[model samples]
Target: MDHDETGCQAAPEGPILCINNCGFFGSAATMNMCSKCHKDMMLKQDQAKLAASIVNGSSSSNEHESVAAAVEVQVTSVEPKSVSVEPSFSFGFGSGESSEAKPKEGPNRCTSCNKRVGLTGFNCRCGNLFCAVHRYSDKHGCPFDYRTAARDAIAKANPVVKAEKLDKI
Candidate 1:
């Protein structure tokens, strides 16, 4: 907005307010503003900064998307795809080959090596899918601690002993 639109004439004496005109007791709280007029100017500056940040952030996200696309390309190159062309017997009607090709489904990959694994691969209780080699929690560097298993086993084996110990304690 222009200086005229602000309705705030330049202060003749003070940096804050028009001491000659309206005694608008100014707010010095933020942006050195005596009134809403100055806050409007600051708001525009803040919005500009926010817009610049968003533009810069979008560039970084484009870089990340490129890396993901590269990975997808690599996976496609590594896999062998067999295209099955169905024979169309229909001259005008239908032996019926589907116009669109169906996407091929591939086996699940091991989280550790990114190698394809069959149905025999293990899905760990810790929630990770791995191959037979890293099937065990210990091998996969799983964070699940099984210390409670021993305690549960002992509690089950000597229930009376545990009851006596608890009562004594």
Candidate 2:
């Protein structure tokens, strides 16, 4: 409950303290030992195992080599893997082309006037790309039936609800 001279509060006594008494927080995976102490313990265990194997003289040179190879594999597996990423550009209005496929006239050109619209190209419902001027249905003379599409959409969204006819009670 008291603050030290450095203006930092001291850690209260609890079961969370490291069992190794190293004045650090304990981890459940490391048998309640701090990370540094856990690593040291692991190294000591590995060394003891190696020593015991050597003293027994039962393990062959081939077995030792295999163990070393396994350890090397573990070390390599722990390292982060390198990933290669290639640049992919996709315009949603294209003819379902793959990422690797290149466009014939590039995506920047407007289909109506063939003008360079760049990022300002508008996508029409008729599957044609257009510039700002020809973005509207009337401007591009779009053949996709707007009124029919709207009526169909509305019908689909709002289904008919009729009251059940009752017979004479």
Candidate 3:
């Protein structure tokens, strides 16, 4: 059992203290209070760092979409506007691929690891349809800004994505 500042075991009756100060799922209080401090449990560093990054509107290791969006935003921000002097933010979403849609060519094999990543999360830059193990997140870390990647993923997965047919081609 964990104890708080007073050396008394954390009370099970009150709100259980989160095991880590930055827990997103639950708290350590459910188990017990701090053994040393005997106080409410706090989030651990890894969890705290993740939570802080999220709060700051940045991308986290767990959220890949956030990383992608952050990247797009960063890419756009660096370009200077010739006509407008005022700051502006745009929310343009990505084009979607239909489930029924078939690739006109052949399955895109990753040149690096040769894994069949399918069309999902394909990195246009490297021409790789790699599994998560070979993707940028695992390699270069989440490239997108947490906020942008997260928002983009959410937006992409939401109702906005309409399935289109490529039969016209």
Candidate 4:
């Protein structure tokens, strides 16, 4: 989730820093953070858990406190995480006229038919526009390069043909 330059006050950028020492896993994860922070926190937690498991095996006394302290230290060190910033919406089209509004695009036009067609997905390579009927569903629609898709489809289909050949051999 992106935010403006002002920064996201709506939520914490990092996992709600492990407040409870009595956490079931040593640190209670309150809520989700941005992807990057969440990944790091999970790694640290895994390490802490491994350490706790090992320590518990060797010592009969209360090793939980030591593990909790370690988790707290790890959590504190990950402070001041960054938030993703969303781009601002704008309506300026490249038109030089400040007063005239940009013309709205009508229905999607297919390159092959030159007519309005349903959007399956757009072609990435040559940009030869396509509708659902013209699309290859197995390849995630006609968005990818048609030539590439055709070649890939042939290659994929060859496996079945080859199995038949092997049986005859």
- Which has the greatest lDDT? 2
Strongest candidate by TM-score? 2
Candidate 3 lDDT by residue in tens digits, 1-169 = 4456568864356555445544333436444433433332233444455446655876656575644443222233334554323222222345563324355976666545676666654573434455666666456454446677678888888856568877875
Model 3: ten consecutive residues of lowest lDDT: 83-92
lDDT of each: 0.59, 0.72, 0.50, 0.51
Cα lDDT for residue 57, candidate 4: 67
lDDT for 115 (candidate 3) = 67
What tens digits encode model 1's per-residue C-alpha lDDT throughout 1-169?
Answer: 8779999776546556533235655544544445565665676675465445444665367755543332221122332565433222111123465434589967888888877787777887678789988888878898765778778888899877333445545
Better of 2 and 3 by lDDT: 2
lDDT tens digits, residues 22-109, model 2? 8998866788888999988987786567556655866788967744433322122332575443322222335555435554865587
lDDT of 4 at 146: 61
Clashing pairs in 1: 90-95
State model 1's lDDT.
0.59
RMSD, every candidate, angstroms:
25.7, 19.1, 25.1, 22.6
Q: Scored by Cα lDDT, where does model 4 land?
A: 0.51
Better of 1 and 4 by TM-score: 1
Error of 3 at 34 (Å): 85
Candidate 3 has an lDDT of 0.50
